[model samples]
Target: MLSLSDLRQRPLNVLCAGDVERHETTEWANSDDIDVRNRFADLLQRAFHA
Candidate 1:
């Protein structure tokens, strides 16, 4: 069977992509279809810095 060490060896980029996808989904749900995507971008930056 695979060991815990093997799991830890998984690619880091995969984890990052999951986080990015979830963030996009959240922003889309809270935003309107007409406005610019800038607000979402700004919110993400603020959240990261905070």
Candidate 2:
């Protein structure tokens, strides 16, 4: 996610609830509901002016 954001040169807003080495996780990668994607989308949505 951060990689794609860096590629696009955008503001990265990350809301983390725990300490971690890296953000990458199998939880999102192997699930029907993507929590990481949803969180990233939340950041994107708030960044956009309505």
Candidate 3:
């Protein structure tokens, strides 16, 4: 598991919870979750609007 501090070292816009989870189980490499992509897009939109 990646510590919060490790995740914080990079730009938040390019990282998400799944990236850390992938590091643990390596299953995300085959993930097809559109919801995650939508969430990231939403976050990016919010950041840009702010």
Candidate 3 structure quality by residue, lDDT tens digits, 1-50: 33223464467535665544323222332347766556555645676786
Quote each prediction's TM-score. 0.32, 0.33, 0.39
Tell me how far the alpha carbon of residue 31 in candidate 2 is from the true structure, in angstroms, after superposition.
9.8
lDDT of 2 by residue, 1-50 (tens): 33323332223334333432344445445556677768656655666744
Write candidate 1's Cα lDDT for 1-50 as tens digits.
Answer: 11112223456444333322223446544666534355555555676786
> By the TM-score metric, which is better: model 1 or model 3?
3
- Once fitted onto the true fold, the runs of candidate 3 whose alpha carbons sit more than 4 angstroms away are 1-31
Query: Candidate 2: lDDT of 15?
Result: 38
> Which residue pairs clash in candidate 3?
none
Show the lowest summed lDDT stretch of 10 residues, model 2.
1-10
lDDT (Cα atoms) of all candidates against the true structure: 0.43, 0.47, 0.47
| Candidate 1, position 49, lDDT | 83
Q: Candidate 2, overall lDDT?
A: 0.47
C-alpha RMSD of each candidate structure in angstroms: 11.5, 7.4, 8.4
